[model samples]
Target chain A: MTLPAEYLATPRLPLDEDGGPVFSAPWEARIFAMTVKAHEAGVFTWGEWAEALGAELAKDGDGSGETESYYDRWLAAFETLLTAKNVAAAGQLADLRKAWDKAAKATPHGKPIVLENA
Target chain B: MSAHDHDHPHDHDHSELSEIELRVRALETLLTEKGYIDPPALDELIETYETKIGPRNGALVVAKAWTDPDYRERLMKDATAAIAELGFTGRQGEHMVAVENTDDIHNMVVCTLCSCYPWTVLGLPPVWYKSAPYRSRAVRDPRGVLAEFKVELPDDTEIRVWDSTAEIRYLVIPKRPAGTDGWSEERLADLVTRNSMIGTGLALDPSSLEDAA
Candidate 1:
């Protein structure tokens, strides 16, 4: 599905200055800028991203030269970036994965807390 | 508009929740009864979040970015620390990240997996944002969706869509509006609508505020 023009034309605030595009509010912008800075500093490269993403997509055996499957590829690329940069150690990521698993098990169906009071 | 004039059921009468709220409550109850969560604890958590870390905090952060260039720079680099600079970091925003827009590239964020947002800075994701229409369309055709919201960008701009799947969350920093020279941060914050921060609209100008009034 193509993104709507209205969504595209929305003037992005974070992009106002040459620094970078803010993802959400200023705080979110700040974190994104840091990530970009890190990427530019040779902490990671796009090739690593492509490789990681390629590997992840390969698991499904559907890497039929489709760009859409690149989403998983991007995720894998980011995982590699994090590991290479020590932004997250493999052990730490594993622990987080385990915690997420536990949380999912404890709260299956993913009901949001917003509806609890009724 | 004055906060008092805004017709929020929660502010006026707690007993009369909106239909959305009612559905949310029903879902909560179902989840609890089905052994998905601890009802009372979740209720307390939700209440604590709504009362202490809602839209007001988001407004404050946006306002600060508008007024303070140094702070804005810090915010664009380390959102968690920058927001913490204002003492607004907590919960969902503990791992907050920011994305900046440039002339060549524009950033749009979505949680295709779920409604993961920097709630500490953005409060709640609007109903439309969580809709399947938005999720499925945002990354694929952002320009068209933005147009529906009345935000039209130049064709030359490259769109970079970010999907929030991990604990890391995103927020958009909107451009400072025109014709607001020497405005205080507090006033600027008032002009920073949630939609602007979500990259769905631009900051309101004085004329738009007058029209709204």
Candidate 2:
């Protein structure tokens, strides 16, 4: 459950004088910037994330917070943020979940498969 | 009434469960009863993927990139389109992007939330890539994670970690390996490994394979 060091530390990218992470390749800086912006926008408070993450970690029966789980906690936080912000109408998220479930069930590869009729 | 309990023979509580949960439970039970869901079989399948399919698919993509400049450029800019150009686009690869390695920069990819991998392009994700251990660690200590995979970058090289979200999937475009001069695309493709495409390992050279042989 030990986390990798790179995940824990913030990366320093080559930047111009204004100090923005430079993007030499496609979509690299955009994704990084979005992550940073999402954090700053009060979409999900870091404290809430830490608490939820700590709870999940505790479920592993490991007291140490050394390990960090992938996107589950973030998804949960995003869901909460969406709910709080009223971004979608009531039950939209639930509908999407149901659709995803149906798609997973219908496809052998656990993806949404489209079958064309002859 | 409690002593007899005849009227309560079938529990009504089962009807209260969610449809998805009920369906899942029923499917699991049916599969188990049919003897089609053996734990050993599942383990074997997992092992096969971990040992074979993942790496093979990765190698093919890397080799193609190494030998074909146009393909490599397309992959770097619009991965899904580029992969479709090669007639290998569907399923998990519907939305894909490629991250390229350069002289001063290195790239690594991870699914920070769930194991949302581009399986069509890479066949299957390795056990480490899908494991909680790797997912949690890769984001925080990419260099350390790469080290575990035996990929050590120079100190001067900047590392860029790509987090694959629910919408978009990512593939790592490893820098073309040395000693592959005048090799065919097919030969180059043979040197591409799944780990290389995932940015955990480097692509092999045809000369290296020749040396080993």
Candidate 3:
């Protein structure tokens, strides 16, 4: 029942008054968690994350636009960092993305999506 | 409950995936397959931020600082180590600077560049904290923002706002209330509100605590 203290870490984001879900969508939560996990695993440092995210937000010009969700920047920042850090290449990520698009289409409604479906 | 219960993994309409959704899933799959990510670590990380960390950690630190002089000295000298002494250290808290609220100096923290907060101590920054207006005005008119939070500091007090960035974060040690002279650290912690640590508001008045209880 006692997780290591490191497991119990990071600043909060996305929580509203109701103490609702920390993220608006499942993918948002996924990317958020993945970023933290990657940091812990030594894939990248939080400094690197901050830099990447800041760069992504900077691309938005004022960063208060209605078009892109906040987490979109998070994901964009993450993907860019992943490639920049050589954790994964741009071509590799792109390939996987296209494959998932196909896999999701192949999956039936309410079914768990599997990469094999690609 | 909404039909969007993502925890029910099998119940999601996989066929209705948004472009971003599919992209994220693909990234997860790729990272997992590459051994750079442990699949369960994602959930564990989420559970950590969602439940493990919070402002309570900062309250404990503030309370100890109030009750112990040597610890307070250490805290003022180096906040990151002082906070880690209470066993609250991780990514966002790598560098910390504790600024105390004195009779003439009122300290506040803001991440004007982004939401770079000391999550390891005070948990996440609030939604409004990330807004453009608060971010800008926190530097321009801290006293006004404090007034909005009902923390009317003395007119002569100089408000010092610390802009947190990726390199550093800050914690404000609110002044000990007049009547809390012999209070236990635990009791003192009850007065240390999250806003107090952020410098947006003062610690809860001792009388207010009594009234609430």
Query: lDDT scores for all predictions?
Result: 0.54, 0.53, 0.72
Winner of 1 and 3 under DockQ: 3
- Using lDDT, rank the candidates from best to worst: 3, 1, 2
**DockQ (Cα-based) per candidate?**
0.01, 0.01, 0.21
Q: Tens digit of lDDT per residue, candidate 2, span B1-213?
A: 011111223322111223433332232233334343543444333433233221245456666777778777766666677777766655333467777788887888887332366766775455566566787788788889989988888999998777665456778878887877887877777777777878888877557788978
Task: Using TM-score, rank the candidates from best to worst.
Answer: 3, 2, 1
Q: Which regions of candidate 2 deviate over 4 angstroms?
A: A1-118, B1-41, B49-58, B112-115
Model 3, span A1-118: residue lDDT tens: 2333443332223443544334433356568778767787788878777778777877776557332266788888888888898877758877887887787667654244568843
In candidate 1, residue A24 scores what lDDT? 25
Docking class of 1: incorrect
lDDT of 3 by residue, B31-69 (tens): 787787887666655554443333468999999999999
True lDDT of residue B119, candidate 1 = 64
Worst 10 residues of 1 chain B by lDDT: B6-15
Worst 10 residues of 1 chain A by lDDT: A7-16
- Weakest 10 consecutive residues of candidate 3 chain B by summed lDDT: B1-10
The Cα error of candidate 3 at residue A78, in Å, is 14
Question: Highest lDDT among the candidates is held by which one?
Answer: 3
